[model samples]
Target: MTRALLLVDIQLDYFPGGAFPLAEPEAAAVAARTVLDSFRESGELVVHIFHVATAPDATFFVPETPGIGFHPAVAPLDGETTLEKHQPNSFIDTGLETVLREAGVTELVIVGMMSSMCIDSTTRAAHELGFVCTVVSDACAAPDLTLGETTVPGASVHAAFMAALDGSFATVTPSASLV
Candidate 1:
């Protein structure tokens, strides 16, 4: 089966000094770069997914802003496939499925930011679409989350989401093991 590498929302907005920086996003990007390089070396399919918020009330990832640009560490190289999306699920109106199907990609190696959001959503969607997904856990970041009176640290949020996704949705792994 053909496999592809999917880098989701590793954009400027998630890094330090950006709109909504996540916890240790740089580390995640570095690890993702490792996997990206591996895919490039193998001449495998690599798709870079960017989230561009077009809503009038959107706060981050606004259109035509540097915040929406892909981070340098995992930026798509020349000739690599790049797709933009308006929602957390990368497949929604993004032509990602069509692209994958055309490329005969049956498996996905996913790495990105916000483990609790886009990463979770995309992995679930990919799994349901019958693609074998392998998430690079260390190559995905998560922001601090708070609801009601409780606030969860990003590390805890990341670990919890990774735990939830393992086996059920995707095979959660690390960059080192992958490459």
Candidate 2:
């Protein structure tokens, strides 16, 4: 089956010192770079997705901000396609489905930042859209979140989301296993 590496929102805003930093962003980026290298060497399709927040009240990822740009480690090469997204689901109005269909991609290997948000959204959407998905657990990270009186740790949030997505939406694996 044809496979594509969907690098979702591996951007500056999610990295250290950016607008919205995630836990262990550097480590996730390093793992993603390794998977990216494998995909490139295997001659598989690679698509980079970046989120651009258009809401007026948004604090990060506003258009023209450096934080919206891809991180240096996982930056798209000249021939790779880059998709700009306005929502958590990368395929929403992004022509991502069309691109993947045209490339004959049946399986997607997804890895990126904000595991509880973009990664979760994209994986579920892809599964509902009929594409087989595999998410690299160690190659994605999320920041701690507060709900009501409980403050959840980033690592816990990341693990919970990965587990949630594993069976139904996608197969959760590690970067080393894929590489």
Instruction: For each candidate, give its TM-score against the true structure.
Output: 0.98, 0.98
Report model 2's TM-score to 2 decimal places.
0.98
lDDT of 2 by residue, 88-169 (tens): 9999999999999999999999999889999999999999999999999999999999999999999999999999999989
In candidate 2, the residue pairs with backbone N, CA or C atoms under 3 Å apart (3 or more residues apart, or in different chains) clash, namely: none
Give candidate 2's whole-model lDDT.
Answer: 0.95
- For candidate 1, the per-residue lDDT at 11 reads 98
- What residue pairs clash in candidate 1, if any at all? none
Q: Model 1: what TM-score? A: 0.98
Per-residue lDDT of model 1, residues 130-153, tens digit only: 999999999999999999999999
RMSD of each: 0.6, 0.6
Q: What is the lDDT of residue 146 in candidate 1?
A: 99
